[model samples]
Target: MGEWSPDTELDGYEQLVFLLPEEPTYALEPENSLVATLVRHDAPRYPSALLYLHGWKDYFFQTHLADEIDGPGYDFYALDLAATAARCGLSSSPATSRT
Candidate 1:
């Protein structure tokens, strides 16, 4: 995964880009160099971590969920899939509506 940076699309969220390994089935995929973006709320109080993922072709961007999860002492992190992030002008991401 790449370095963490302030999210340009989602307020109160941090973003990180992961340069995935070259896909062998590149022809099946849209992009050659595939990448995944991780959006997170920087409030971790425990050793455990929680990884949140959204469904395919869906709209789910709940900032409050992160806060609620963080309240339970979990290091909250959510995946923005490549395509979703891209759609939101996150440069390279994928998701439905986050509004």
Candidate 2:
């Protein structure tokens, strides 16, 4: 993990929570609900980001990354897709599938 200097400010992550219904004639649908968190930072210019993939039996719940993300020019986001059951693995639901 790299350091996030000392100028980062606003940092957070957006999580998809729900899905929207599509017309029957359509071929695909989208999500409808999501939850995001306004990360806590003590900097003022975080401009970079780092996203991590969650392995089996793991979920996102760390704040230290925020400490690094909240820097002068960098922002970081750690995601535990598999563990969260939101998106991961070989599922085609899109709700928990990644290629």
Candidate 3:
């Protein structure tokens, strides 16, 4: 499905998932990955959008959340942000020092 605008009004439970990578941390290239999911009911005339942010260690695998929001024409969205090594329990990339 095509991307929906945030301003658009949604009708029922229908959404889209999107994976986004961190900009600053991308250069570091951590072992773990971060992803984001955006969901919303899309309609030609009226489209509604919902955006949710999840921690790096946390993910939007909860189907119940979707079921709760699921209705005749409502939509839901979830997002996961890249977390630091501290949160992800991984080795932090050391920055290079230039003389």
Error of 1 at 70 (Å): 0.7
The residue-by-residue lDDT of candidate 3 on 1-99, one tens digit each, is 235444212345343433233434445455333323343333432255445566455434565665566553345565434343223632122211000
Give TM-scores for every candidate, taking all chains together and pairing residue i with residue i. 0.65, 0.36, 0.42
Misplaced by over 4 Å in model 3 are 1-22, 26-46, 84-99
Mark the regions of model 2 whose C-alpha exceeds 4 Å error after superposition: 1-14, 17-45, 83-99
Higher-ranked by TM-score: 1 or 2: 1
Candidate 1 lDDT over 23-61, as tens digits, reads 332344556344566778753468888889863553336
Which candidate's lDDT is highest?
A: 1
Give the lDDT of residue 45 in candidate 2. Answer: 49
In order, what is each prediction's RMSD in angstroms? 4.9, 10.9, 11.1
- Decreasing lDDT order of the candidates: 1, 3, 2
